[model samples]
Target: MTSAPITAADAAVTSDTITMPLEDVIDPDEFTPRLLALLSNALVYRESHELRRQFKLGTNEWRVISALSMRPGMSATEVCEFLGMNKAVVSRSVTRLQLRALIVLSDGPRGSRPLYLTRAGAEMHDRMLPVSLRGQEIITEGLGATEVAALNEVLRGMLARIRSDAALQGAPGSPSQYPID
Candidate 1:
């Protein structure tokens, strides 16, 4: 990475332009994979904050509602796995939703209790559905149907690669098999 030319006009600049922003120095649309992931997470944070403010639901709570709405009945561990969220956060959210009368617990195989959304929870999901749908539309505004499908396929591949790495890390002797450079 090279620094911009320094001159009298640039002397007052204190920003680390040399290495601070790779996207800004290049075409803004061309982003590194790291930056793309960061931006995707940041967008989720922003959306979650807005939804929390508007609907009186925390991000995790909203996610629980959303997940149950889709999956009908899922354990906290299952929700955590599906959402790639921390177990504690999902557990707390499950408790909160239950206390709020938004969800109900039901017995499952092996004495497990899976969560299911109540009528109120379904109503909330109905109301918040537009927010996510519109957000998706905005995110893929300029893309054709084919392009959107391709993007989804590529994202799935990327997620699979990361999931494989996570699975490997959990296996015994895996780290020793592939030492970090």
Candidate 2:
């Protein structure tokens, strides 16, 4: 059966006919996506912050360390590709991690390229991995396995759509579809 139309008064009240909570009263279309994004980002930031504190490393350094943990020796370009980051940012992060003795860079076959991660980097990653897993568990506590899978599929589809639209807009000679930033 189709749902009934929502009136302003119905939207403002709970099932018990009492005024809904402030969060519940907000317009869904106006605030749901923003709220969800902010909440997701906040959780990520909090976990990253805790990891940094435990490992004595910044977010960028942690990313480099984590990348190296997966593979001991990766070039800058490889790391950038894995992390979806630009070269300049990766270079700066690598330099800082190297200076801190968390990672060591050795010359590679191609023009003095560096392969990264020291013993300290591995240790930090090991220490923080459990915490990260715990954080993830907490975030997904109420979600059933099926629900989690469904959410993942939905989010992936949304990301693909967004990326496809962006690419189409950025293609040259496409009538300048979107106003360039």
Candidate 3:
């Protein structure tokens, strides 16, 4: 089973570039990968805007907070590895969060410090949780529980496949990071 190719004019989002005409290659509406990227981008854009307005938080900072919320005691290196984010960016966010008194670090051997959320950080995370959940609810409004579960199953499988592919191809450069699982 294959989807028909859609032209630039037909899909309006087949290609990112505006100067060149997008060929009837892949219809983002029908293509799973393109659809996934578009949806992820939409979610990130929304998060970036809302977080900045609501919490004065950048996407990077929120990402770090999110990782820590799920897995406490993660070092910056561990966060970078898990989130596939740039070390420098994560470092800066960590510093900012620390400055805000939202996060604290535990001393470790050889200057390796594990990150932990402060009382205020946890409170902020609690507040932010509803926002994220609401965004998810909005996106899944028409879908049944079973359908959403199936979609997650598919996405998880895709993530696993991509990780395996990346392992085979070798790690990407520091400038490019893998998707956070």
Candidate 4:
């Protein structure tokens, strides 16, 4: 069965039928995609703010550290490809991380160097884990385990479908990079 068109007329009003103007009745919450995107940005901003205050790390740096923690010894280009970030941003974050002594570079063939987290970096990542997990807990506080699992499954399926369609279309520029599974 199809759902009714969401219109201003559906809103509650007096029995006399005075209603809100149509232009003013566009509820943002009804747009699932935009709502989800806004929610994602808000959550990211909150977590990033706390991470910076606690660890003096920007979102880019934390992304690099998190990526390296999972897959150690990734070259800068590999990091960019893996993270879907441009070369310049990743390079700058890598430089900052190196300056902070959180990452070390090891020489490879043809002047290529792979980045590895220093002992300090690993320790810092260990400390940051719980903070990230706690942010997740806060967001999912009202969701049951089954609901959480279903949400995850739906999101993953959507991502996979979009990625597959993009690949097939081969739309402009470089190919898109996906999150590590």
In order, what lDDT does every prediction score? 0.77, 0.72, 0.85, 0.83
TM-score per candidate, chains pooled: 0.72, 0.68, 0.78, 0.77
Q: What's the best-to-worst order under lDDT? A: 3, 4, 1, 2
Question: Which has the higher TM-score value, candidate number 2 or candidate number 3?
Answer: 3
Candidate 2 clashes between residue pairs 3 or more apart in a chain or in different chains: none
Give model 3's clash tally: 0
As a whole number from 0 to 100, the lDDT of residue 160 in candidate 2 is 64
lDDT of 2 by residue, 1-181 (tens): 9999988866765577755466546676688678778777887787778877786666666677888888778887778777766679889988888787888878777576666667777777788778667756876789999988887788767666655687766744232222211
Q: Which is superior by TM-score, 1 or 3?
A: 3
Judged by TM-score, which candidate is best?
3
What TM-score would candidate 1 get against the native?
0.72
Ranking by TM-score: 3, 4, 1, 2
lDDT of 3: 0.85
- Which structure is stronger by lDDT: 2 or 4? 4
What residue runs in model 2 are displaced by over 4 Å at the alpha carbon? Answer: 1-32, 171-181
Winner on lDDT (2 vs 3): 3
- Lowest lDDT 10-mer window, candidate 1? 172-181
